[model samples]
Target chain A: MGDGPSNEKGAQIMSLFEVLTIIVPSTLLTAAPLIFTSLGGVFTERSGVVNIGLEGLMGVGAFTAAVSTLGLEHAGLGDASPWIAILFAAIAGGIFALIHAVVSITFRADQTVSGVALNFLAAGLTIFLVKMIYEGKGQTPYITHNIDKINIPLLSKIPVIGPIFFQQVTYTSYLAIFVSILVWYIIFKTPFGLRLRSVGEHPAAADTLGINVIRMRYIGVVLSGVFGGIGGAVYLVTITSNYNVSTIAGQGFLALAALVFGKWHPIGAMGASLFFGFAQALSITSQQIPYLDRLPSVIMLTAPYVLTLIVLTGFVGRAEAPKADGVPYIKGQR
Target chain B: MIKLVKKINWMTLLVPVISVILGLLCGAVIMLVIGYNPILAYQSIVESIFLQPYYTGETIRAMIPLVLAGLAVAFAFRTGLFNIGVEGQLMAGWLASVACAIVFGHLPRVILLPLSVLAGGAAGALWGYIPGLLKAKFKVHEVISTIMMNYIALYTTAYIIKNFLYTEGERTPTIPAAASLASPFLANLTQGSRLHWGFIVAIIAVVAMWFILWKTTKGYELRAVGFSPDASQYAGMNVSRNIILSLTISGIFAGLGGAMEGLGTYQYMTINSTFTGIGFNGIAVALLGLNTPIGVVLSGALFAGLQTGGLTMQSNAGVPVELIQIIIALIIFFVGSGYVIKWAMGRLTRKGHK
Candidate 1:
């Protein structure tokens, strides 16, 4: 009888560990897309181009990925469908982003307004196309094949850390992490990064140095599109396995918030994305926790956004945008 | 001839007109590509909005909130700010008005209705104040703060409705008739349409917006700051205070929009999982209207007509209502690229001179 109580306590500790294993893996999966998209935001904002149309770009990517995967699967590209879809999505996203570039850069349209319009355009066009393709339906057919989780051969056999990080994790998540680090190095350590930063900070100075400000800005915007597209495609193939109007809902915005909350740094954005991912995972799994069940789930739902606002107000007072950010560069005007 | 042409303000009128035409033309091309009759589609839309009394009333009813929301955006734009939190502010006002109605619903119509609306406006003002204060105090971008505030308002209101005001089926109880904006006289006149007293409220708001923006000394300060904040600061104006006041007033308009929906249209608040697209649409409306008082109402009417007519077009012409959204988006895109249109027009004029 005395051993009964101790046995129950031992089981409780085991269950707690089990709970974490599930939540932590899910959190990484959820955060991978945000990290990629926010890194994209970092690239564009660092080059003095404001990309509020990441949501639209992501939507384009998600829709294109789903549609292309369906076609490729039909053509008998069984295991390779998702990979090919990602490539197609990235291309579509980069092409779509050129609209924002042409409007905001070439025509000197208001960047914010152009972004808003792009979102509406994306939503409308996607739904319209969906209806046309699906014979007056609102969504595409379900994707049969999805990206699978892979276990790292020997690394996943290690202790708790292995299960949390390597076991049963999507390859896309690891790729996202690697890309975040790679983007950080490129932004901070490369000559290209220096030129991009200089153009964002002072276009006149960059122009004086013979750097093509407009061309650099276009490349930054297109890079943002590529990363954001990949992020959306990853989210679709790994998380949802389908494309609808709501597939990329507000994730792009969440990524943007993460970008700003991370103070426009690649590494910081990754951390913020992971934090948001953890919060989302908690919200999904909170019912299983004894104490968490008592708390309202709305708090968790609002946490990422509210926490971002708090961070922006509290810690990021000096989080300055590049000086010439959002201004249309007119030659010889300054 | 030059003086006459200069006095015409052609640039202001031309861009929006040309953009609208271009949007419609593009919409037509899309319909043609889809093997639908664009002319029939457009005619059905026009007939439903104009000839049908019920649809006209519905269109006007829809315009009430949109006009106010546009004013909300336009007000902030005039003060050199973007108030994307209109969605959040509108939502806060919606819940506050409904909550007030539930509490004070026993009172007479005159007292309860106005009180509930004022409560809503006050709640929205509070919601708007957060980002404005953040911008002024911490140098936080209003854009980011306002966007965050939107989600916060979204989840917070959903929680409030679920926990505190749960009537049934993810919606609150309808307000008492005493506090409702529904007018039997207006409804009967409009063939049982949902038109209400909120139309009067919208007109009053428009006049008030005009007066406050053009007639008052505070208006001058707001406009001056919008022109150049540094210049206004050097001229002894408090830039931060103006920013706060501008956002606060914008919040009032947006909050009133929510109040119109609650007391006027639905007569209750439902939990919204997604943002009501009206806030984003208001940005387009404000842009189309050139942020002017009268222009906002006209453009609001135009957009509301498209929406109301879109339903009829869908039913009659076998065209999906999504086409209207595409058209609207195209209009915004064309409007955003007005400089291109201006350049093209300049070339045309120069060619005529040759």
Candidate 2:
């Protein structure tokens, strides 16, 4: 696939159409899990709870999916059932999320520490589980076979956005985008959205207005867990297609960055996620691009993180958080 | 004397002890649920950390960095800066020291070792200063910058080790004997094992931190700024300069932590891995220590004990080393919830219990 002055696809200057093809398809594949995670962050932060453990939650979810796929394959289900494996991953990720929720939200602990704890927890636990399950092997079985790829025949042929992008996009990307829209609508237009936002912006005020702040925070956290779980499962199945130690890597943090970068808006989060996915995909494509590839590898790995730094530093909601995100909302005595 | 003892910050001492006990109790419950032999695991943990001298030495070795890392966090905590880049700083220190060793391989130990240590500290200071500068100048949150710095540090350290520092054969050059600070005397104390002068260095570092943080006028300025930057500014303190200084000193301590691991312990650095978890561990150490130098040293040693013994629990008791990590999480969770502990204490006191 060396496109540099070598052959047919190589010699032709990359058209905007060709660029969109390569960028879009890969962007969605990478963006799916990020969308789910950032969306989860949106809910949590909006409801006034910061979910730092998204990384750990995703790690646990990814590992659990891998383990479940193998266990299911061993249990006569065979490797053909990606759905079952993904389901198992969701459950595992949820359980992991629950650990963070219970520790941070329920117990009213420092959210950051709890989040960091989750990362360590997942790191240690996953490796330990790997040792136990694989005995000595560091990874689970490959999954590209079972992971289904969607093919929208007609949609695939559309000019710039079709074949290269739409045709190869995973089912999860579509689901993630839909979920973002759905979350935005629910958060903005629905009664529950107002309540969640109210609780975040001013928990005490919301409580005065008869909203259950604790309950809302709990709901927000639980929902976060669900999204995180989905993020993990989708990451393994759609993006990596196999589970290893570093499989989950920085995706959870990327989702957090997307959440911050998107200013906590669900739809905006989608755009932010696409940007990150494009940057990440571009890092790899740097090898193919003539002048772009000249950038150092260190800079390439750092591109996404540096972008996160810039976005968080400059663009995040400097206005104000929903007043009581980190503070534990007491019932009354205030 | 009794009255004075009562006046001392009991919370500082009791908090960690109480949390550790609670953590182990919770861990025991988890172990029971998993159907693991909790008793055997606990026995092995104690044996590994306390009963065996060599094992204890390993724990102390681990604690050196933990304490230093903890001091790094506590230094910022005192200033309300919450320097989260300790991990990044530690990595920077490790990279700087290792690079020094590689580049200045021919110097005598006297110059080489001191220069290497200084280089590590300087690198750490540089890493710490980035976020400090960002916060001081642009109002960019140090938390975000430091976290980003961590990712940058990880990848860069990995690249440097893999591409630049690794010997021609792909593995890094073995640290020369003269360059290594591992001492036979210290090793004998640990059953002729890997224990070294680093532990002593860690203690000395802790004392120095204590002096810098408590006795010095700069320390007073930092604490004042922590309480109220506005007030400190009114009192003629340069808040921005303090921010930068706080981070620089913090970074130096973290660099020393890396030196402990590198010159004193490993003698060579391995990259592309999670070599800088010490920075994260420092947060916990700072919390456990109540941001006091002595407390941090104690907490760091305890954490080191956990690390070394946890490895033992993995190899000997067949308990996953991750169990220690769970204990750590539980500890952090409990520490963060001081109100919960205070309430528990209040209830127990009311009930006429100790």
Candidate 3:
């Protein structure tokens, strides 16, 4: 494997085409989850609810998806377990997000504190469940079947785009891209989007127009949970193999960084997530690249986070949040 | 005299007390559901924390870092800056202290120990200052920047420890006795426990945090800025400077907390693949303490005891230590929703009077 290519394939070694083929698929898979979760962030923040509990919500989704898939497959549900698991994850995530909504929106608790509490609660609860089910172990059993890669017939025949984009693609990754455009339409084009933005920017004005501010915020937060849950499920089935305490490690936060770095727009967040995904892919593929192997791996490992910081500080041009973001809307308070 | 007693605003004290009861009750329900004996579990935790000398000392040892961390968080909270970066600051501080100890190993104990502590604080200040500077200059939210800072700190510290200072394993070389905070007398007094003089440092931190926030003009400025940046600006105060100053000071306290862990408890720094969770735990302590110096000390000790006792609960009650984490999380949830309790109580009192 290490030898220079002697044949046609060998000549393709370290070639730009070869590099793009390997890197593009890996980057898409890594960024898919981030795309979903950051889009979730966009929904919630755009409606003026700061949903930092995406981390916990993602955990709930991942754990639920894993356990449900395991149970369903055990019950002889053939070939359909993964889809069912995603459904379970979305429901679980939405349910878990209700805690954040009740505490932050209904009771007017500090959003960040509530989000932190949810994270702790999710971590403890999931591990506790793992122990109870697995007989003192901290992880679930790894399943054999996972989300499969598909090659589009005509698209896969294309010269350059076929190998890079069409082959070795998970349906979830395409779904993620499609959903990004869909969410952009829902957030920017539709009446619901208009009302949601109005509620976020000036709830009093929105309320004057008979728009229910509270309900809009709740919808925004709950949609975030749904998307974040799907993000977790996609990440578990496609990226990692099993459910454990570390399964959803920091992806939620990274997604949030992408959200802010992308200036909270759906397309922008998708772009930023792809950028982060590429950085992550580099960390894994650095050993394969002759030039990259010479550089210290630490730089690649830390690059995504540092880049997020730099992006926020440097090019966050008018990345404005909702005017009433993080503020509890009282009935008559100014 | 009767009116004075009635005007004491009983809710101020009652809120926390009631929240604790609610949290414990919820924890008990979880225990019962898991088929564990809730009474036995609680008993084991209490016994392990109080009845054993070694465990008692360990609890105190644990409380040293926790106390400083809580103070760090509470200090930031009081200044209206939510510092989610304490964990990163602590990591930075820990690495800096170990580096200082190793580099200045030839110095006398008096100079080396204090120098390492200062180095830790300085490193932490630098970490905290980034988010503060970002917020003050670029209008970046501290929460996002600080969270990013934490990931940076975690990987960077691990890389440094692995490549530069690794001694025997994934840890740095143990500091010499001259630079160590371990007290032979204290260890002997606690029956060979790992207790050290960091307790003294924790106390000093609490007092200093209290004094700095209450007695100084700088404290007043910070509080004013916290209360309302626009108002403080209108009053001719440097709101931006105060914001940066508060976060920097908070970082110092957290960094010193890391120093206690290095110089006092472990005498060496080990690389952590994940966050130590001390910083997040500090948030719980700060919230439970109501963001006051004395309150943080008391709450920090309480959490320390719970953590120390969690092990006994695991061994004695046949339960997982994760249960304690659930209880702690529940406690924070209850505390965060204190307004709900307050509103209910006010309604109850009014209905009773009517």
* Every model's DockQ: 0.78, 0.53, 0.75
The Cα error of candidate 1 at residue A129, in Å, is 0.4
> Any runs in candidate 1 off by more than 4 Å, and if so which?
A1-9, B1-8
Question: What ranking emerges by TM-score with the best candidate at the front?
Answer: 1, 3, 2
* CAPRI classification of candidate 3: medium
Chain B TM-score of model 3, please? 0.97
lDDT tens digits by residue: candidate 1, B157-266: 99999999888878999999988999888888888999999998899989999999899999999989889999999999999999989889999899999999988999
* TM-score (C-alpha) between model 1 and the true structure: 0.97
Candidate 2 deviates by what RMSD? 3.7
Ten contiguous residues minimizing lDDT sum, candidate 1 chain B: B3-12
Tens digit of per-residue lDDT, candidate 3, span A248-317: 8889988988898888899999998898889888888878875788877778777878877777776645
Model 2: per-residue Cα lDDT at residue A31: 84
**What TM-score quantifies how close candidate 2 is to the native fold?**
0.90
Model 3 lDDT, residue B271, Cα: 82
Candidate 3 off by > 4 Å? A1-14, A150-152, A314-316, B1-9
Candidate 3 per-residue C-alpha lDDT over B1-354 given as tens digits, one digit per residue, 9 for 90 to 100: 887577545776666667778888998998898799989998998997788888899999999999888998899898899998999999999999988999899999999999998988998899999999988987778888899999999889988999989988789999888889999899988888899998988999999998999999999888888889999999999988898999999999999988888888888899887888899999999998888898898889888998899889999998888888888888888888989988998899889999
Question: For each candidate, how many residue pairs have backbone atoms clashing (under 3 Å)?
Answer: 0, 0, 1
Alpha carbon deviation, residue A31, candidate 3 (Å): 0.8
> Could you tell me the lDDT of residue A298 within candidate 3?
77
